[model samples]
Structure formats: structure tokens, C-alpha cells
Target: MADPMIALATGLSAVLLFLLMIGLTVYLLWKRRQDMRRDNQLISTNSVIPPCTPVLQTLQASSYGSAEVPFFLPPSFKSSTHSAMPEGREEEEQWKQHPHLHIQRGSLTIGSWFPLGSLRPDLYQLPEEPSEWAQPSGSTVRLCFAVQYQQEQEQLVVSLLQAANLPAQCQSSATLVKLQLLPSEDRHHRQAKAQSKGCQPQFNDTFVFQVSNNSVDQCTLRMSLYSVDRLKKHHLVGHVLLPLRQDELQEAAGKVLWRDLETDSDLPLSKHGNIQVSLNYNQSLQRLTVVVLRARGLQCPSNAGVSVQVSLQIHTQVVKTKCTPETRGSTPTFNEKLTFRLLPVQLDAACICLEVQQVGHEELAEVPSTRATAPVSLGLVVIGPFMYARGRELEHWNEMISKSQELVKQWHGLGAANNIYNNNQT
Candidate 1:
């Protein structure tokens, strides 16, 4: 009886110990799972609120000036009615609902939770008034003008009028006027004959330009006045630019308009000078030859002579050969030749620039002697790729390129240094 009782006690003790071990194992597993879940929740919270960098914060602050621009809560932070829905699908739905946030300029405020504010009046000022010529209106524009007296110039022996301003100073004894439709390369242009020159010279001659209704906004009527010198070179006196819009055209259509001629900023009121050049290309030798022939209408101080130099540039490659300085005079003749070695493949991208510079004098004497000393900048003319040439320039280039190994000579006009090249590129 004693032995059986002892055995039962031993069995009960073993069973109790086994049950305790199993309970301990289950508690350990549950605690680990709770810790993992807490960690995952912290990670998701961090992802929802991204960290802002210093640079971005500074940019936002500077953009608002001293104004307190509010920052509204993102869609993800906004209260939602569907909070009970599945987590993954709800986040996606919130993003889809608020696809874009429209924020007006200077409306952003700092620290405030609401994005409600009127745009600063100073920040949202209206743009500048557009030019009358840029207005888009479909109305026929008729431009009429008469060449009136030009004030200021003393030597007015002969004069010519033109609707279009010539690139180089005109070297023609005959005074004539030319008018052409804008942006068209056609040969349809109007002209008027040359007339004798005088202060307040009355042209009394009236001309008209008929612009299309659609193109009236872009059309500009240019009136150029040229004086004929003893050498028969047409020196540019001055020009006037008339914008042809519907309102201005309608108001001035029947009435004769007289306005003062405005000279180019670089060119003097009295003509400075003009350079003449001849271009020839030899296909067989792959050489380009340029001849600086003569310059006319050069203005100089009393008893002071002018010296001139010519430089030829193809792209950035400048020719080592520069023409020798011509004799001191208002009109100097160089008759020097400059040659450049080139290949057929290079001509497509080549641009020829001829720069005529005035040397010898420390400063160019301004007219009337009271004005400040001005630097001498004679003029520059450029001949670009064949495809880019126009009118007479195009004709000249075609003639040269067509005749292989033969010299093709033509007179080219020069304007203020860099003006022709800059205008062409623009």
C-alpha cells in the first residue's frame, strides 16, 4: 500500500512540471509577436511623414517674403470617413481623390494648417502693355507717307527715299524710294525716282502700302532717306519706322503723315563712312578671296585724316592677312586682297565676316566739337551660308559658287560693327 501511494505521488509531480513548461513556452511567443507589431507601426508612421531637407525649407521661406504662408495637411493626413476600410486600399483611394493641389503663387503660409489666403496684389501685378503692332486683329491696313524736310544736315546735294532700309549705306547718286511687302522674297517692290536735296526738301510725293488683313499686325513700314555724294554713293541720312496696326492705319490712312527720320543708334546723325568689298571663291583650289576696294563718306575732324584697316573672319578662324592701312583721308582706297583656304565640306557651315575698323586717331572727333570724344567703329558686313543669304546677297553667292575657279566680284555695303552679323543670327 505504501509503495503504490509513493508511485502515484511521483506521477502527479511529473505531470505538473510538464504542464508548467508548456505554459512558459506559449507566453514567450506571445510577447515576441507584440514587440514586432509595435515596431511595424512605428515604421509606417515615419513613412507617412517624410523628413524635409534644409534647402527645401529655405526655398519655401524665401519665396513667401515676410508673409505667413500656411501649409495645408496632405490628403493622407486629412480626416476620412472610410477609416474602417482596409489600410492598403484606403491609402490608395485618398491619393486618387486628391490628384493635384492647386496653390496660387505667394499664397503659401508657414505653420498654419489651412491653405486659405488671397494672392498678394504686388506679387500678381498684370504684365506690361503689349506693343500696338502685336495686337491680333484682322483688318486691312493702308500706310501712306510723304518725304518731308530733314533737319540738321548741312550738305544736302541730292537725296533718295526708300520704303525699305538698305543694309549698307546706299552709294547711289540717284535718289530713289523702294517699297516691298514684308517676309516675301518676290520681286514685287515699288520705287520712286531720285530728287535734288535741300533742308526741309519737299518730296510732296505720296506713296501707299496695302497690307493684308491677317498680316497687318506684323507689318512695319520703313521709310529710309539717302543722300547722294559726289562719288554717287548713297549715304543713309535717317529712317522712320511706322507700325501698321488696324487702329493706327485706319486713323492715318487718308491723312498725310510727316515725321522726323530716326537714325540707327550706332550710326551718327551725320553719315560716318561706308566700305566696299568683292568676294570670289575658287572651287578647284578650295580658296576664298576677298578684296577690300574702297571706303567713302568717312567723316573726320577738321585737318585730321582717317586711316582704315580690314579684317576677314571665317567662323572663329581669322585670316593672318589683313589689308595695309590706307592713306589718311575722308575717303581711303585699300585695293588689298585677303585669301582663306577652305574645303567644300566646310562651306556649308561657314560664315564670312568682314570688319572695317578706323585706326590712327586716339579718339573719333564728334560733330560740333562740343560732344565727347567717340571711338571709331566703322562697320561690319557678313556673308553667311548659302541657304541663309537673301536677295542681292543670295544672287551674288550663287553666281560665285556656280562659276568654279573663276572670280566673281560684287560690291557689298557695311554697317555698324557687329550689327549685320547679330541681326542675321537673331
Candidate 2:
């Protein structure tokens, strides 16, 4: 009984000792965890904190009392942050003042909602239906040349002195000057030799055009400038038209005269000239005879020849085309006859289109083919019944139809070729 009591007491004491040890360990661990948490909180509270940065901000009110709003840009701006803020503020103010204006790819545009594409600015707009003689829009041309007429020699001399301030395109090519004397029967005109490629070319070359003393004052001097490349390509730059008045020529003889080059839209229109024609129809032979008498008050280049082209058209399709021999001068006489075969009933539907064209010649034989030097239409005259013709043209056609085999002669005014064709199209 004594041994059992001692053993039991010892076991109970050992169990209590073990429980106390576990309680102390748990307390220590809890205290350590609480201390670490407090230290973290204290350190975080005492440390510095940065202010929040906004992606976008509102600037001061503009003079118009509108809120200026900055564009939403990330804080990591590409440029310096300090500089970006001022630029943004200025831009924001400008945008608020002008809602229609906006910056696009660094350029200030007139519209904000839509982007501009292939649109020309208002500053470069040109007039609609600009006159042929109107000053060209791009860089202008200026020419320097001299004209002299000697009474004793009965000869007119033209000297191509120099050309200044040529268009920039001429820098890659050689320049030449073509000279023609108006109202003179010079079989062939003269052209100066091509000079070195430059914006300013000096050509002291002189050309002679024979003119009688009686008609010297009635003559005019025409000068045309051209650019020719090494590949034999030709480009007409501009023209200088100078009338040879006796007094002006005498005062300015051999002295270089500077003139601004004018546009080359000098094709002779209907208002610029007139043409006479005679028509006769033979009912028995089923043929139409048209005689081109002559043309007067025409305007053409000096180095060009004039001819009349007659086209017989049934609706939009042309049946036949005939042209007279090319003649020189503003007033030329053709007196050539062109005949077309057709039934009498066909005359009601058939129309005739006459076009006076100027054929230009290039004196330089080396440079052969280019559409730039092709024949230019000077004027157009159409003759037919009713819808195909008007006024004098209609009367002429009616007269010919009424009196078969009887010649009906009339004068017709010239007009633009496109205008005449469009008016007569089916």
C-alpha cells in the first residue's frame, strides 16, 4: 500500500510539470508574434508615403470660361514630366477655345472629327474655267530677246539674248528658242541651238525673217521656248508674242526687251475667226459636194500650218475623213473640194464636222516623235439639219437641201472643238 501511494504521487507531479512547460512555450511564441507585428506596423506608420499622380487633370478656365482638360497621358511621359505639363496646359487651352481645330501628327488641322486626305488647301485653289491666256499658277517664265528691222535691207532680225528665272524642271534639260515673223512669207522658220542645261541659259544666236518694207509694221514677232532632254523629249515652256510696230521697233531696236511669258492657250476659237464654205448636193449621183473657201482672222503659231478637216458622221461613228493641204498664216485660202457619197435620205441623219487645225513643225530633226508637238485644233464648225446645227449653220444646210445641184455659200463662226462635238452628239 505505501509503494503504490508513492508511485501514483510521482506520476501526477511529472504530468503537471510537463503541462507547465508547454504553457510557457506557447506564451513565448505568442509574445514573439505580437512583437513582430507591432514593429512592422510602427515602421510602416513612420516611413514616407508618395502622393498619388493622376493620368489627366483639369487646368484653369480659359478666357472663354471653358474648362481646359488635359489629354489622358500616362505618368511615364516620353518627354520630361515638367515640360510636358506646360505644353499640355497650353494645348488644352487652345483646344477649348477652338473646338474645330486639333493637332494631328504635329500639324494643326481645320477639322477635328475627320482626317484630311489628298485635299488641296484653300490657298492653292484655282479659278474654274480659267482663261487660256490667264497667268499660269505655278512658277512663271520671263524671256529676254531683241527685235530689229532694217529699212535698207528689208529684213527683220530677232536675237534670242537670254532667258532668266526658268522653271525648275528646265534644269535637267537643254533649252531652245523658236522664232517666227507674223505676216511674212518665210517658207521655213528658224530655231536657236539648244544651250547647256540651266535655270538661266544664254543664247546670243540671231535669226532673220524676210519682210517687205510696206508690211513690216503689220508684222508681229512670235517667240516660243522649249526644253529638250538628252532622250530627245520636247516640252513647250511658254510663249512671247510681240507685235512689230514701226515706232516701237525703232525705239527698241537691238535692245534687249524683257517680257513675261504668257500661257500657250492661244488656240483660235470661233469668236476669234470665221470660215466660208459652199455646199452643193447632186441627187442623181447621190453625192454631197462641200467646198472650203477660206478662213480669216485666225490665230496660229508662227511655225504652224493650217488645214481644214472634214468628217462625215452618222451619229457618233465617223464614215469618212478628208483634209486639205496645210497652208501657212492666220488667213489662208483653201478653195479645196471634198465629196461624200450618200443617199438623199441619209442627209437627214448625216452631219459634217469641219475642224481647222494647226500643224506644228520641229526644226530640230534629231528629236523626232512626241505628242507634245502634235497638231493642235484651232477651231471647229459643224453643219447639219436641225439638232446638229444652229442659226447660220442650220440655214446653210436647209438651203442646200431645198435647192439640189444649186450652190449655197455661207460663213460660219468658229467655236471650241469639244463644245461643237458635244452639242452635236446623238
Top of the candidates by TM-score = 2
* lDDT (0 to 1) per candidate: 0.50, 0.71
TM-score of 2: 0.34
Shift of residue 366 alpha carbon in model 1, Å: 10
Over the stretch 174-293, how does candidate 1's per-residue lDDT look in tens digits?
A: 454455444445767565554443332334354544444666555445556666667766666655444444554445534344344444442333244555556778877888776565
Collision count of model 2: 2
Summarize candidate 2's per-residue lDDT along 400-426 as a digit string, tens digits. 988784457667888865322334543
Best by lDDT: 2
To one decimal, what is the Cα RMSD in angstroms of model 2 from the true structure? Answer: 23.9
Give residue 172's lDDT in candidate 2 (0 to 100).
72
Q: Which stretches of candidate 2 lie over 4 Å from their true place?
A: 1-270, 361-369, 418-426
